[model samples]
Target: MEDKRNIQIIEWEHLDKKKFYVFGVAMTMMIRVSVYPFTLIRTRLQVQKGKSLYHGTFDAFIKILRADGVTGLYRGFLVNTFTLISGQCYVTTYELTRKFVADYSQSNTVKSLVAGGSASLVAQSITVPIDVVSQHLMMQRKGERMGRFQVRGSPEGRGVVAFGQTKDIIRQILRADGLRGFYRGYVASLLTYIPNSAVWWPFYHFYAEQISYLCPTECPHIVFQAVSGPLAAATASVLTNPMDVIRTRVQVEGKSSIILTFRQLMAEEGPWGLMKGLSARIISATPSSIVIVVGYESLKKLSLRPELVDSRHCYQRFTDCYKRLYQLQPEMTQRIYDKFITQLQTSVREEISEIKAEGNLEAVLNALDKIVEDRKDQEEPAWRPSGNPEADLRSALVPYFRQQRDALQRHVRKQEAENRRLAEAVVAGRQQVQELQRRGQARQQAWQALHREQKELVAVLGEPE
Candidate 1:
């Protein structure tokens, strides 16, 4: 349930390379195999001449089914699965190379070119034979030709194709053309894939970004990928369609050598002959590209869990990003980490109260603990404790944050001490005032007594009056 996007860093050492290679390849194979029938049908339509073998895509499908059954539609499935190795090679190379490039330069255009070129080069080397054989199977007919299939199409173009068993096809290709036969159209295949791949990636990225810009703020990311994926694929398909035709013709059994095949197509069909199946290529390739990109991204979201990335390794990447960034941009510093410390201080200060304050450090220490957790997501420390900066910052800042509680307690104690002195002063002043009042009362009484006595003396002296 952990959000994978927020997982900022993943160390190369921590990643299980083999596991992902297998998974990526296997998943890609599943999707490709599911869509193989359409591919086979498209290839069949492309290989036909003038009037063509069948009227359209559906007619071709119906004809192949009526003549060869369900298994006929999936003619080269076994050999095609061999392409899985190439798929894995492509994905793994791209991921490793792209990460390496992205770390050095922030430009996506550069990263896409480097990653795409390197990946295509490596994968094509392994998959060229598989492609040749698979195309042969896709074009391969079901029944043995007796020079009588003119009723349908060319007789020499196909023979009985033994499906299900890939080894048989391998042996057959070997008997006919030896080791070199496997790489029949290697150069053409490379020409078709390498540049197209290099261009497709950048095209996809560019279009995706453009679409995202045009879209409203609430538009989903998948929508951008969806629109960009097919458009990029269709463009690349058109540009590379000629190379694809050459690769296919050269790869087919009994076809002339690569150069001879190019000449034959040119001499027989003219300049546009190389772009024979442009429509088929676009139709098949666009959806394939879309599904692969979207599916791969979705799978990555599922697999690259924050919990699985090993937070211990993520700490180093998180730190390294800053190190690399600051080295280039000297003015920048780690403000987020500082923000984390500030938030902790504020949160802890709010908890420091007269009621919560105690002689023991329990309340203050508890507040410090809460601050560590409260600021963890903001700072994004290790998910599983990898000697992260959060722990170190906690150790360093506990005392500083504790100052809030300490200052509060000190103010409270000062107020209490002053209150004691004020009470003592008030009591002493009250006693002094009481004593003065008593003296005044005593003096008044004495005066009264004296006055009474004087009155008595006056009375005694009254005889003279």
Candidate 2:
């Protein structure tokens, strides 16, 4: 009887940091490896000029496989994997920033948007350089030509020797444009990813909320998240694709500025060029987003502190009861339920702290009694007769409270029975111990008597004749 609406989001404070980081990095690395081929194809598609090298996404994959083999699909995998460091930074910043912003805002959308943007900004400092190098590496295909553009080989006349070494790429970049070459598309990357993150998170939350509401109550929260993630990513990819195109071009093609790249793209390739790699980006992003979101949610669940997991289950059960009570009489019961929940939560938290400090079950019982008494006192006035006879609220509430009371009484009876059984078991254990002790004493006495008998017989035998 679990309620889908009762799904608790594990927050930053509740996480085991060591587990989160270790699992997060491993999951992100696997996701990147899985989707990197599509990324390579997308980058290649974005950088191509008029009279395109490949007709579409499938065509690009086939041509790369035929021309350069499977390695062509993973050209920059090493450089790309290095971005896991930046991924950690992004996740940390996002979680911390979201927690901070949550104190001021009630809207999940606003919190996600701000947190996403801040995280992207922080992550880009590390990621932009890796992106610059990786995108260049992605472009190094043997005998690939796009209209008038041709891929250059090494001075040694070997494409593999030229593109295979990271040092050579760094040296070439240094020789061409100096240190700034490592950050060729710095502004464009920010423009692309910051907004993408900002938009994607809000949309993700929105879609998840909507989908969860529309789906049956038995549907799991993870299902909602799985469906929402790809939709949000596809939307973001399409929205910010022009900037992504510009960023890739600036980094790989060594364009001077974002504006210049845009001007040239428009002049040479027309408005449709803005969406050159749209299909590839969407194709890569959808499955990548699904894996990332699902993995992240699973990581949070796995990384939750042991104590919080119990508390989360307790809270969910409480929420289910609250939902049932609210459904009894929607208008009046809501107010009572809200007030009760607030007071109950506060009382429970205080009682838990006391229990942890003092290890006192009496304090917990007393706290529960006080909460129930206080709620009864507050709700007594509402139970009084209203002016209308047919539209009475009391009729609806009476049965629910009576049902709750019966259930509580049954639970108490069950607990008392269990306690009696435990007491009887303890008494039986003591009796068993006592019986063993008596047997040991009798055996010792018998052994002493036998020794005495043997000594007397020796005496009677006259000292061995």
Candidate 3:
């Protein structure tokens, strides 16, 4: 009876594992569909620099909506969705292949690396054309000045002739350059996506294991999973960001060949040109990748076991608990979970304040402010060009210390001259006073002598001292 029960348990585990994959596939598809707008916006924002599109993510979205309406945001979504679905095929196949490799391999790390790299290569090769097209489609729009019917990449017509719509642009490409034009950046796409995607899962698993070991067994599963995904995604992003930048540029431009495009960018600005939007890419990719993987993993787990969801649990389920297999409203579940999390965060801040004494809190806040100010100063660029309007205005109004030094020198010279002049005037006035006194004395002496002469003459005739 005991032996039979153990066999049944093992069988049940196998069944659950199989069921989980099926559930995971559906959930991942839904998540990707939901986030397509974000993905599209992020890609476009990364590609276009010096244009209004480069302003920032939010601004780009707003512009797209205002210029093209709701449809503009999801411009290439059909291509994107199809490509994503195709890519997932590779992912699924790669997972199976990786499992086989891992099972047969002696070393876990080697197995992971090989499995990841091989899977990426295979998947990317299969989807490169689709990827390129999707990228271009996302970037395509009627240039803001162009009318709705104006096609981008239209034929060389007369001066200032209006362009056509996106579909028209597609038709033009087909007419002018054929299928090859639509798949222009296929090689670049493959080169970028394969290695980047390949390294991600391996690194993710490795870090996740490391974090799990560091954590106590009782530590929350969600915490480690959440932390590991971000760390792994960040590491992968930094390593592969240059490739992503190139891919985005190639896709956006719709060049005829990868080699020509590469040469063009290199000739224009050297190798650094390929990394134009690297900062924004990293900023967007790292966090988004983390959130995506973490969300996917958590959802995947729940879908495997719908019964694990418990609504009664205060913080764990209330805040973090997402429904596993609710057919009715998966998105609604996510919304509820997010709201609960917001509330919990608010409560945590309030609780911290309640626990800490007000006196000590003020000191902590001061320290925090100083730290924030230091970070802000570090983040700000050391210099902005004087040609910039803001910089020009600021420069004109605020005298630099160097200018202040020159002004001070001129002031000192003027002050010294005034002091010398005043000193000379004082000396001249004193000399005049002395001269007058001397003259008066001499005059008095003369008067005295005359008087004496008179006295002497008189003395001979009667004068006393």
Task: Point to the candidate with the largest lDDT.
Answer: 2
What are the per-residue Cα lDDT tens digits for candidate 2 across 109-201?
788899999999999999999987777777777745331224456575534424445666777888888999888889899999999999998
lDDT (C-alpha) at residue 233 in model 3 = 68
Q: What value does the lDDT take at residue 157 in candidate 3?
A: 28
Clashing pairs in 3: 149-164, 149-165, 150-163, 150-164, 150-165, 151-163, 151-164
Candidate 3 TM-score versus the reference: 0.51
Error of 2 at 70 (Å): 1.4
Poorest 10 consecutive residues of model 3 by lDDT? Answer: 1-10
Compared to the true structure, candidate 1 yields what TM-score?
0.62
**C-alpha RMSD of candidate 2:** 23.4
lDDT of each: 0.69, 0.80, 0.58
Candidate 3: deviation at residue 220, Å?
2.1
In candidate 2, the residue pairs with backbone N, CA or C atoms under 3 Å apart (3 or more residues apart, or in different chains) clash, namely none
Q: Model 1, stretches more than 4 Å misplaced? A: 1-19, 144-165, 254-256, 305-465
Q: Give per-residue CA lDDT, model 1, range 1-465, as digits (tens).
A: 211111232323335665556567767877776667777876665556533466666777798788877877787787789888888788778878988996687565787789888999999999988876777667667443211111122354343354433565567778878888889878888898998888898888778778877877566666777888889998888888778877776776456577887787788778877766666567667667777568666556445645565444443354454454434532222334445546766876765654366554686678768988788778554342336556654554476568778999999999999999999999999999999999999999999999999999989988774
Candidate 2: minimum summed lDDT over ten consecutive residues — where? 379-388
**What is the Å distance of residue 318 in model 3 from its true position?**
31
